[model samples]
Target: MNSPIIQLEHINKQFKNKLAVSNLSLEIQPGSIVAILGPNGAGKTTTMKMLLGMSKPTSGKISVLGQSPNHQQVRQQIGVMLQDVSVIDGLTVREVIRMVHSYYRNPLPIDEIELLTGLSEIDLKRRAEKLSGGQKRSLNFALAMAGNPKLLFLDEPTVGMDSETRIHFWKQVRQLTQTGKTVLFTTHYLQEADEAADRIILFSEGRIIADGTPESLKSGLTKRILSFSAQHGMIPGESASPSDTQPDHNNANSPHIHIKAQIAMLPNVDQVEYRNGRWSLYTTDTDTLIRDVIQRQLPVRDIRIETGQLDDAYAELLATMKEEQ
Candidate 1:
């Protein structure tokens, strides 16, 4: 395995009375894309800033490309697209790319940068201020890649991009990784991480909640939801029906039954609605729950079982973390 291209050892950062990032340690390998995912104020931006040397760590150490982040040589091998736009508005698209290229020793060819970024459609002569949000984002990407840096940091790179442009941007990112450049980025969009990252680090409350390949993180959350519909009416909860309300027609009436069972203790199962002649249940252990439901609940009319989706796992993980905190 290759040595880590970036390393953060027990990194901590504080502001006044608040600890933005707390004892966060992470590693990024060469040619890999690692995405940091979190909600607002989770310290993702602060972590990235620390790695870039824009903000100093209150404690701990950070190294990028085997050297301290503050090292001039290490700085040359990195490119950044901050959440706050940093381009000069007066420069044209081509001019901005050229200016960034001028700062690097062996930048990518100007025509290649234009082609790779799909900037051919934009008027290269048009000033950055005149471009649409998506256009500007594409230009930002071009500038970041212009230097051909070995490591790149993109903070919320697709914030205002349209679906088509975002798709194109991801394609370009994949191509970059193929060329041996490492990418470390932070995104609020979990789907973006799912699509682009080879590995995902989930951050919550100034800590790493989870870290693994997208599939591994998903598989680690292996949960199944079992659902079914029944002809007979079923009570939603575990509580028994009131004895006083028992009607003589209870034995004869065939009302729809709905039961919601949560398997593996996942907190996704709300009250199951079984009106209109249908029954449904939600659970994390599909096969086991299905078996249990079949044996215990009995007489299910139709059954369906499926693994928990990425969104479901993510929600459950965060909810569990929040509850613990």
Candidate 2:
């Protein structure tokens, strides 16, 4: 395997009396997309700044491309699109691109940068400072690519983009990875990371809390809910319905009084609840439970599935952290 393109050892950062990042350490494998996620003031921004050579770590070693992050050669091989996109005083977008191109020995072509960033001819002619937020971000994106860097660092890249543009941006990033470019981005959009990154690193309180693929972090920490409206049905190798279940005194006339218990007996079902004429079954093994539901030929309709999302996992992790503290 190729050695990591970036590495950090016992890294920490402090501001005045506040400890921004605490004992953070991780490595980014070459050609992989990684997302750094956390709430505000979680040290995510600070860490990225250090990696970009804009800030010095209070203590510890950081290496990018086998050399110090601040090394001139290493700086030339990386591109950055910061959260606050900057514009040159009076340069047009096209001129801004050209100026950055002059700094790199081998730069990406202007037309290709335009194609990758959705910059129009009119946009290229406009003064950089006069562009809208999204437009400025696109210009920033184009400038970052001008150097044709092997590694990219983007913070809140899609903040001001419309849905179509946001979608396009991620698609472009994915394609860039196919050519062996590595990307590291930080975003509050958990779903974006869930959909885009090959791996995810979660940070909180300036410390590493979790690091794994989206699937690995989600499994065993969250649940999936399967729901459908079902008529009384039979379970193979078991009675069609429990005959001995005592009728509840208050709900003796209600059909749902016994239905809950009957559904609870389904394979791999952990909890069953019914509301609005639909039954929701909670289970970790939705696949097994779904198969059982189908094979039994139960009279069911309006089948719906709700898998635990990254948002759910993030919340669960945060709550756990609070309880531990």
TM-scores for all candidates: the values are 0.80, 0.81
lDDT of 1 by residue, 1-325 (tens): 8899999999888899999899999888899999998888989989888888888999998988888888999888888887765558788888877887888888889988887657655578788788877777778888887878999999999988899989999998998899999999999788789889999998887889889988878776655555555432344432333342222324433122122222223244443534344444554556565556555645566676545456666787998876887
lDDT of each: 0.76, 0.84
- In model 1, which residue pairs have backbone atoms overlapping below 3 Å? 224-284, 233-255, 233-256, 234-257
* lDDT of candidate model 2 versus the reference: 0.84
* lDDT winner: 2
For candidate 2, which ten residues in a row score worst on lDDT?
231-240
What is candidate 2's TM-score against the reference? Answer: 0.81
Mark the regions of model 2 whose C-alpha exceeds 4 Å error after superposition.
Answer: 229-307
